[model samples]
Target: MLFVNSDKIKSKPLPSLSENTFLRYFSFAALYVAQGIPEGLLWYAIPAWLAMNGKSPAEIGSYVAVVGIPWSLKIINAPIMDRFTYLSMGRRRPWVLFGQLGLILSFLSMSLIADPLNNMSALMILGFIVSFFEVSQDIAVDGMAIDILPVDQQARANGLMWGSKTLGISASVAAGSWIMSHYGYFYAIVSFSLVISVIILVPLLLRERPGEKLLPWTNGEASKAAEKIQLHSWKGIFKSLYKVFFLPVSFIMGVAAFSYSFGRGLIDTVLPVFTVQELGWADTDYSQIFATANLISGILGMIIGGFLIDYFGKVRMISIYMSLLILLACAMSFLKSFWQNDIFVTGFIICFYILLTFTNIAIFASAMQLCWKRISITQFTLYMAISNLGLAAGAALLGPLKDLFNWEYVILCYIVFAVVMLVAIRFINFEKHQKRVEDLEIKHPDINIG
Candidate 1:
């Protein structure tokens, strides 16, 4: 129902970047991979490394809580992105490039820190800075996805983007664990810097669209017609945020987003500690099972889940997946007694990971559906920020819960969160809200209402 007015803006030949689906998806995947590596290093590899180095579970939890603050606070950066742009070089590219540079510097700084064990304070500060850059890059990459991908392609794009990130995290965990095990912490940090250097090249080389200005050397001029187009005001940004947060359907979607990953966060924090300290699993063993094998299943889930959401509808897919998650959580909690049976434990964990990934893909694709293109980055970031906050809250609780009740109650808590997630999905009438958005966009074609 929504239409683009070809005459309003200058027409140019379609660039290979946009015309080729493979190129577009590849670029998206590469950027996402760049984002994921450090995330995996900090969240998974670092904690395990710290635990192995004799840091208490509580200490590691505090560190993770501090590092995760940037991601949960991304709502603050989203509006800044929406309010400003270097349009001549593509709206989102400048921010993306800036974030990537900051990440490189942050990683390099971490590698320079002399005594990681004795310098926990310095390490935590550096980790927070690294996460800040990573979160910024995420905001820009998401904005780029909204700017380029068509509505029909968004579901698949979300899957590939997230799947690629999973792969990156898997690789980071596998490689980081191995490197730190055989080599040392310094070398491991250096390896992360080297890998990120390679991945950052993807966004550096590619333009946002055909004929967009390149930084530094290019004249940085927009087409005459493009120059005449008025940018949306701050009032418009506030309006879009209001619509997403205040509308009944979108409000429910936000609540569902907040609930969807709460259990995963608690489990993610506790499981590594339990596997390493309690179960006597080595770092490599944990990485191989949870990061590598489980994530491979997650990649399959993402691919399958993407198609299913597009075909069956987002609400239906989410409902089914969340219900499955509850059952899986209950079963896993029951299986905790049989932790000695490595085969059973591994299999159940894999199933849970797959379902988690599947549900996440579906939920994010639904969030994308709710964003209006005029302020896509800000709106979508707000939804994801809420979700990240829930995850952080769950993670922050892991240590205290473990101290009080041990692993069994932790798993029980996950089951309760999963039930709440399912209940939240019931109130989201995405179809009705989407119809309203589409009708608004069709009426005012110049303004992106959805």
Candidate 2:
């Protein structure tokens, strides 16, 4: 039954640009900014920069593997974040603040450490810690967004957060590269730390609601039913873990994940070597092309793709983008062989990179939307964990494959992956998923937008 109450409807908060708008935008912006800095350090800049420091393609792969481990493992901490709160800030915000603080300190440590021969192991260890905390923050922020935001507002929130994240990433990478180029690695780290420090101030301005869960045991009741479930049953625990691990979406996405990551990891792990050894490009040249491609394409894809997914459904957009990405990858692999001059090679690289930037962002936005709110933070972490695992698996396999068949064959692998992604998207059926979500929203007004 659709319940309509004119007075009651007026009582609920609506999104706006005055006081309400300020709070919503301000708080989310802070979350994204905090997230953006460590994301840049751990995901974007570190691996490539490490390669430049004479690390082999395999070592670079290892770093990518190391950093990604936390994402897959974050399921352990996700539930705890849901059930626990600290210092009166509610469950999610307190942890987010703490995680960002830890990340800032970790980045500072990277800046202070020098003499690669003496501190190489230390740097990798620190990088691992930063990755852990960064994933922790991601868990909390994602959970908080779902837990607090109204269902009607969730779409806008997702779009805005992604858009802001891309912007922050662009700024971080661009600034990090310039600082690293001119002053050294130290300043780049310090500058990111300052950016994160500003991000921490977001919690001071926002409020978080208490957590709750729906339960089938008490006739679909939120409070009493959830309380009735066995909190520490081995069967229950196993089931929760299994539910996320064996999810239908994971299996469907896994095929695409495998292919996408294989191609991406190979390109990332080997590209710098290709650039310096094969093409003789300078460090600044590499940074400039990447930053420009990333900034423009990433932001555009997130905004446009978010709307498209909501409008056209996840499957159609992903299928289209994946095809484009495959074509570009093939072009790039061939372009390198033919174009001896720096100018032509650089142009082709940038064009190939822009295609990747577009498609990858589209993929990520779709994945985020696919997550069900009922999964909880712990399950959410596990979902991200498995996704990372797929990427790492692809990365790990890239080295041996590159040695056996050569880079061109590796590029062919990407084209194959695009085919797999398109095949998977066929199963998504966005209208059905949207209706399911809408039905849930109507039933429980406070349902999280996972």
Which candidate leads in TM-score? Answer: 1
| Residue-wise C-alpha lDDT for candidate 2, range 354-399, written one tens digit per residue | 5565555455544555454444465445545655665666667667
Best by lDDT: 1
TM-score of each: 0.80, 0.69
Candidate 2 Cα errors over 4 Å, as ranges: 1-26, 39-72, 82-91, 104-130, 148-163, 166-194, 210-238, 244-250, 273-284, 332-338, 341-348, 403-407, 430-450
Once fitted onto the true fold, the runs of candidate 1 whose alpha carbons sit more than 4 angstroms away are 1-17, 50-63, 181-183, 219-232, 263-288, 330-342, 392-431, 438-450
Task: Itemize residue pairs with steric clashes in candidate 1.
Answer: 372-450
Q: For model 2, name the residue pairs that clash.
A: 72-385
Write down the lDDT of every candidate, Cα atoms only: 0.78, 0.61
- Assess the local accuracy of residue 54 in candidate 2 as a C-alpha lDDT between 0 and 100: 74
* Candidate 1 per-residue C-alpha lDDT over 210-250 given as tens digits, one digit per residue, 9 for 90 to 100: 66676657644643322332245776577656755676777
| lDDT score of residue 45 within candidate 2 | 73
